[model samples]
Target chain A: MIKFSKQQLKIPQMSKPVYLVTGGMSKFDRAIPEKRTEELVIDAFLEAAEFIKKSPEELKEYIHSCYYGHFADHFGDQLLGEAVIHDRLGLDPLGNVGIKTGGATGGSTIWEAYKAVASGYSDTALAMGWERMDEVPTDEGNHYIASAADKDWETPMGHIYTGYYAVMAQKYWQVFGKEEESFRRTLAEIAVKNKGYARMNPHAQSPMKITVEDVLNSPIVADPLRALDCCLMSVGASCVILADEKTAYELTDNPLLLYTSAGSHTLRVADRRDMDIPLLPNESPDQYKDLGVRFPGGDRYPGFTGFLAARMAAYYAYGMAGIVDPTEDLDLVELHDAFTISDIQSYEDIGIRPYGEGRTYVESGDCYHTNPFTGQPGKLPANLSGGLIGCMHAVGATGIMQVIEVAQHIWGRWSEMHADEAKWKRFNRVKPDDWTDLQVKGAKRGLAISHAGVGSHVTATVLVHPDHQLKGRG
Target chain B: MTTQNRGTVKVENGRYRVTGNFHYAYPNDPIRDESGKLLGITNPADMTHIHAYGGEAPFFENLSNAKLLGTKCANPKCETYGSIYIPYRIHCPDCLMRNEEVDLTELARKGASVHTFMITERTGAFNTLEKPIRFVNVEFEGVSTILMGYLSIGEPEIGMKVVPIFQTKNPTFTIMDLSWVPAGTSVEDLPEGFAF
Candidate 1:
């Protein structure tokens, strides 16, 4: 591991070293039924490339490198659709190298881009992720992913991604004392909020506002989780243009900054790790105790109130954002609402509210975009752009979108952030000085948190607003 | 399209076995062999193995070549009684592997009854037209791979002992190679309009 100058790592509470020039992207998947993966990647490229306003050759010259994020298992799907980048932008092939990680390939891809800029490796680099999942049949697609799973223990048990997570959800329900309805409520809220948000994003794969009642009432796909709770089958591509501060100022008037972002992952097995979706291994009470779930009664972890990955990702995020206290500090937040329960659980895990008290935040109306329930000068308003549930996650791109979501709101790009919420109003705003006693006061930071679920593996990240902006954390 | 309903091969008393769902096919198509050689083919003997389980392999170790195997549920005396399956289930599906080690044994390629069938005109990867096709769910004696496949015989009847014919190229004994035949062949009492 390379060591960074201690000064570089030392982020001042109010201001930070970094400033984002600009990041551009296309919809999650642009080639659903008609185009090739190339078209999908090109869609995002053309979009961000347009912002450069440079001739084809000129844009190519600016791209220090290209990192293609993909999850295709075979050669045909290996590299990112760089063929499009070469043909359209006329870039040399050397810059394009396929970066493959499991489901979070996109999140990791963004992480990579973040590092590239911070390290001065690339003044302007294109981080693009794309997939044409619908081209293949469902069973065929499933077979490809299932091939990635452990063939020895999992495949034999007919463990699809669903069953693996289902088992843990079952176990978590039993361990936590949270009610199934509570968890369901959380998930449904996420789905509904996302649906509402997607309606604002014209490019969203599936854009339609649904109600929590509708989500809970949808057909149960795997016990408590309904078909709607799952992410959609998507073929989307998203790109983010990263530029150093000097380059960004030269390009655009308003540059979105990437203050601070951190990511971490755990083991991918139920037996190898003892964590559940709603319960961190280090957290109090086992899944059985928390959910009060019994093997019988057709209920699994019956007590889980929300998601586990949400809490973990949010925890790391709160730490990174310098948010020692959440309820009264964070001005605005966006968590990957892959499921609605994730949002509610995020409220508790991120310390927005006390444990088992997320419901209170919701009930008191301080936790929602419109609530400001705490009314403590400033309350943390969350998921103004819906989230993954709102945006319809396309695996890798979905995670990247979470980062984009928070940044858009901080930069006040909400009009272009989500189409449905184009006229969407900002929910809650917290004054820095009034935030729960965690700082020297007068710290304006916009915090963005993201969580991803790959079977059961989850990653959380926290992003802090830079030192230049020290009014209140947005 | 098939489903988890594929219990075509059964395991009983810890030994696995199956019955053949056979069919017939005319070869010499434009297809080439592994060596890419184009040879005109026409011989029953040369094509008969195409109808056997796993072809040249003894007892058809890998019947995936096209053989249809039948056996009882891995768990005998299940709550639903003796349900049949194909693809050799390791245990009772209802019990989801909870009940293991039911006995499986092979039986004659003949059948004892046909539970039911559906008539349709589907003719492609999807069923969307008004043509004509018949799908039958048949049962054989003792062995349990409640066979689901295409039926050529007209108007199937329950309890009628039926025989299966098979296709020629790469047969390896799956139900596609098999068609239904009358329990007893008699020229003196031929049924009117009975097509071969």
Candidate 2:
């Protein structure tokens, strides 16, 4: 028998503690053609400044540096985007750097800001992401987005962004062996549930209520994936301020701590195989294939590898936070639902469900606001800000947008925002008597997951309310 | 003795062979028509090319000759020694050893099955098809890697047997030169590969 010793996993610790002071995002929509990226950033920055209780000038003076995330300034034919934003904001000539990590650009920028504050280099730092995709035609915009895939292999074969997910959806259907109609209905349910939440979020672009039937009836952008299943391309910007413990206390009474963060990436999805498939058969006698196999490793399966990266990221973050089970430990979640299939796959990838059982969790309504598992209200509400599906995806802005939404839930300020009354009444076709049911009440801990490319890059973060007591700390 | 008063020194066997040279060009200059209508460019260059070495070179050359090739791990201790890779890599991912090139024509001749497929109806920059184009992820028998190519037939079903149809005539020396058609389709009936 081969003896395998337990391996110790190292979790990143900050030299100087970092805290999330506040986060804000502009209303995500396709109608923002008149608004420039700088204007959107300024709007979100001002909104975030309001939470600090400091004058605009004072807040500006406190910020030590700025990190901007943007995807394809060529979409609007603009260059020197970071310089333009820096000039418009009138920040001191300390330093401002631009970041680009495809869809995870927002989260990557935030991570950079966190490092600045955590490293004791800055007392306060600003991370912002914006995209003005509406400036170009749909094809031109798609051309910009397709630049994320492998230019040599994937793009030449006519595999666009939607086609990548569509292939995964098809493979998912094959692996599960469920009825075609039933599988599609489950996907539609995911769309309906997300759009239902979008109706409550004021920042959502398409907050209009949708049905499973409506999703199924929508035109197929890529087979197995409808127009409704894909996220809307919109123009928006999101900003978050990170600071040290002292600065956080000065900013607000309810500061959210950046507990743990992890990110992983694969240049191409084809390079890695799916984790769901059993690489080595249980009955096989080949010990080499069985023992050497690692999750997110091996090329036995053809499914998307992004889910494996997500799992790896989540494990690192969860380990750092001493969280054994994310599904139960997390009070709420903000996941990257760029596509409906992505949401379903995330459930399994994030350890919420076992392999090939993502659809089962979705059908059980366990992830919804009203938890069927506990027969209680707000068990673990996901994508309360409509996610990328209903909230509209501004590419680079999505990661920070997810962080902002999770922060809002942790602060218990989600329900205070305006929601369409009529649409709220018709939500899920099972309207509750009170509007508070829509909110995840007393959410002390939340997780935000974001990804870019075709599951090429992924980031997972855990946030805890400042008031919440830690296990060892007072 | 000659070092003190040598006007010129002769070196023996000093000539070296030049392995390669790199050329760089930029298309910063704009071009205009005779009337200065502002056309595109005269000597436009992207300066980007696929850098191929070792097994990758043969991988493309085989495609030009209407054949498929894969890389096999040379290390006997490697777990996936016998298995083949479609996009041939120089080093084995698991064992970290250089791989040996292998011909995959026989495995492909046995035909492959559709692991998964997607049809895109919405046209984009690369997808300029009048109708939806079906792209299939094929799993060649005995091969470890999956090859992504367009399906020459109509709607593709899971587990459908597919045979590789190479564009031998005037091949573009790209992965686009190869596609998968249904197993029973006659050689004369195979559709043309999708235009890149």
TM for every model, in the order presented, reads 0.57, 0.82
Per-prediction TM-score, chain B alone: 0.41, 0.67
Candidate whose TM-score is highest: 2
Query: Which DockQ value does candidate 2 get?
Result: 0.23
Clash number by candidate, in order: 89, 0
Error of 2 at A120 (Å): 2.4
The sequence of per-residue lDDT tens digits that candidate 1 reaches over residues A165-200 is 443343333333234676557656657655655555
The residue-by-residue lDDT of candidate 2 on B30-144, one tens digit each, is 5555777664333422222334433566776667677777787788887666556676667787677888888777677676888778888665565643357788878776666
Q: Give the TM-score of candidate 1.
A: 0.57
What is the docking quality class of candidate 2?
A: incorrect
- State candidate 1's DockQ: 0.02
Give the CA lDDT, 0 to 100, for residue A401 in model 2. 86
Worst 10 residues of 1 chain A by lDDT: A431-440
For model 1, what is the C-alpha lDDT against the true structure?
0.48
lDDT at B191 for candidate 1? 26
